[model samples]
Target: MEKKCINCSQRFNCRDSYISWLFFIIGLIAAIAIRSVTFLMELGDIYAKIAWYLGVGGFFIFFVYKFRINHRRSRFIKANKLMEKVSGRLELKERDYEWIGSLLCSLSAKKERINYFVIFGLSALALVIAIYMDFVR
Candidate 1:
């Protein structure tokens, strides 16, 4: 009852997938916390509001970028290791690695953009709620 590499049929412990899943959960929690903080904080001054919005937005962007990079790097390493084990060959050229890395980076950027939009949308909704609570009451 041993797990084999999908690429080369070599036997190896399949723990990378589990680790990636763990990281995914942690990333989700971080994202949620970032969103929640921005949603809950009330800024009375215009300058303070501006600073808070920028700070939270910047933090979310940074976290998402780093998270995506780390996640992709871990997956790439795991994939390469599995391929080496199965193929009995380690013929990965620098260009091959670069290509995969770039592809993953671009995909990660796209995902980050989507997340940014969602955060922005949520913030707008929260603003509307705050306004309603302050004036419409």
Candidate 2:
């Protein structure tokens, strides 16, 4: 179980999201190391190559699938941090945190969700541009 960001309208990490990410990283490292070892040894094992590709691909897919949930958590964390400075002035109690956050969510649902989508879309676009520049240049 992982602790969710208090500001999130949706409660997350009912499961082990962070641990899943850790496993994803670990799996990626292990897969790379194994592939490197096998390729360097000139094993020429087709099955080993296939296994490595599938493992890495699966980890990547899982990461993409979980990215949205993680993004929400990040949004919540950022909002909460900003609020922390103003928390005292706002007279917000520990419990009032979620109530106020939820109120904002209801009042500006489109704006908040759109903001997140815009940020994500820009980042993905940047990644694509970077990959193209690196590979096509």
Candidate 3:
């Protein structure tokens, strides 16, 4: 007898909101570290060194998190033949459709929008500072 799975067809919330918030904070630290390194150098060697370390650590953690997510998603797709199903070579059952929908929801999470806004704002600020430091003053 083939047993039916209960949760396989349901929408799953795979991403943790806390992790998103933590990454947002880490992204801010990285942005500040990179932008302030030159300004901090005028304060002291130790200050600049601290900024550099923060920048390195923040970027390292951020990229590792991103790569882990990507790897997990890719592995899931490959293991489940999701792409083949999408391409019409194979038919996806109800469970597969649910899985793909969940993946799409995960990709379009609101937390990502907030993260992108922060990154864009930081980049714009960095540009303004660079312009003032170099061309204006």
Candidate 4:
């Protein structure tokens, strides 16, 4: 599918859309692991231990992915010389604009909306459950 760059009006196919599921799962695991810790702890020590493990594992995976993406973005910035150019001057050239537009386009992911929605929903549910478990019990 061709997506238009909002800044440059250039049409390009987003290749990473399919890979966003991996991001969604990682985020889901991390969110669930974090919110479930206290609730799981109330259940039993073994369950609390399991939740801790899941939380730690999810954090590790999330950070690794974050670092990798940051490194890739750093490389892109270095290769494009965007930092130096922007720091030295206020006006960006046509090529710089195109590159920035491409970067923005690449950073935009369609699945992020749904991912955030699901995460927020899960968090709300977890909060309600926590409240019920703590005070309503």
Give the top-scoring candidate (TM-score).
3
Local distance difference test values of all predictions, in order = 0.55, 0.53, 0.77, 0.75
Residue lDDT tens for model 1, 26-121: 444444444444334554455445655655565675667567767977787676674564377667776565545554444544345656676677
Candidate 3, residues 7-91, lDDT tens digits: the string is: 3233342435688678768977887787677777778989989998998899889878888988999999999999989997687
lDDT of 1 at 39: 37
Kindly provide the TM-score of model 4 when superposed on the true structure, using C-alpha atoms: 0.68
lDDT for each residue of candidate 2 in 1-137, tens digit (9 for 90 to 100): 65654444563422434755564455454444433433333455675676566656755765565576568765865666646646547566676666566545444434335545644664466466556655766
Lowest summed lDDT across 10 adjacent residues in model 1 is found at 5-14
When sorted by lDDT, best at the front, the candidate numbers are: 3, 4, 1, 2
Q: In candidate 4, what are the lDDT values of residues 1-137, reduced to their tens digit?
A: 55645452444433455445686688778777877877897889899788778867886887787678779988989998899988898688888887788777656655556667867987898899889988899
Q: Which runs of model 2 end up more than 4 angstroms from their true locations? A: 1-37, 77-91, 96-137
Candidate 1 CA-lDDT value: 0.55
In candidate 1, stretches whose alpha carbon ends up further than 4 angstroms from where it belongs are 1-108
TM-score of 1: 0.35
* TM-score, cand. 3: 0.78
Provide TM-scores for the models.
0.35, 0.35, 0.78, 0.68
